[model samples]
Target: MTAQGAFEVKLEPQQDTDAPAGRMVIRKKYRGDLVGVGIGQMISKRTAGGTAAYSAVEEFSGSVAGKQGSFTLIHSGFMSADRQTLDIYVLPGSGTDELVSISGTLEIIQKEGTHSYIFHYQL
Candidate 1:
């Protein structure tokens, strides 16, 4: 079986001044009845001139027959001044937990232009 859908997400930066950057807690709720569970990874980099970029990857398992299907997601990109572009990958699962994969990228346009380091995510 195959399933497809789109989602909107909101992010908030919890700790911005920590080394290697702090974790941005994500709270995403989808519309469909299907439920999903997974893990995610985030990475941040800073330059000499106080510029920074960040990326994230998430792997999830969806609800299935008395169980749940699984997926692996990889999102990466850079942010400069305020604008950002993120590349996303979604890999669907097989019976054994791996199979077909779909990928896409999202252009994140920052409305409030500031370097205060408070980021918010909404989906």
Candidate 2:
């Protein structure tokens, strides 16, 4: 099963640099024997060479295979200098779906200064 989500991201200035800090809120819906909706937040800061690092926390609310459970995710990832690539690690999490707890990578492209990130999950 594949999950699809739309995210709204906001960037704010932090005292550290000329580049802004970022926050992303995502709402996702997945289709399967058990359907679900998830909301996640990512907090990011700019690093050297126009790159950025982020810590993400996510919460899921729904039932899977008639079993209702929730989980929290903590992950870290870095964005490339050109903002064209993002590498992420899904770290460990308490959840029924162990497959979700895996490493992932993302590719980001900027259009008019707004970034579009595409994710690739690795188990």
Candidate 3:
């Protein structure tokens, strides 16, 4: 089944080091067809070309279609200097409890300060 939803996220930057990359943790509350809360950690690096690259992992807990449990999603993508592209998907074998056997790709859209998602998955 496919799940669609909108969410708002708050990001908090963690302690900084001498490295060129910035690290942060994310908290997300979701509404609409999917209801849940998730926490994630992200590391962002700025390339010499002025583009950004990011990697993150998020664990979501709640219910999907009334099935309750938790799962983890892994993300890896980069933003171009002129455009951005992202890849967010469930990590293999990462689903737990009632969420076992879950597999999916989550498409995120952000515009004008609003963030939404279209999740394609099977459980």
What's the lDDT of the predicted structure labeled candidate 3? Answer: 0.89
lDDT of 2 at 27: 60
CA lDDT, candidate 2, residue 68: 61
lDDT of each: 0.47, 0.52, 0.89
Worst 10-residue lDDT window for candidate 3 reads: 61-70
Compute each candidate's TM-score over C-alphas.
0.47, 0.45, 0.92
Positional deviation of 67 in candidate 3, in angstroms? Answer: 0.9
State how far residue 69 of model 1 sits from its true place (Å): 1.3
lDDT for each residue of candidate 3 in 4-104, tens digit (9 for 90 to 100): 88999999999888867899999999887679999999999987878889999999888777788888989898888578788999998988888898899
The digit string of per-residue lDDT tens for model 2 on 10-120 reads 433335455477666756554443246657777788866677788777665565444565555455766684554334433445555544443444344457745444445
Off by over 4 Å in 3: none
Model 1, position 116: C-alpha lDDT score: 16
Pairs that collide, model 2: none
On the 0 to 100 scale, the lDDT of residue 20 in model 1 is 63
Error (Å) of candidate 1 at residue 121 is 24
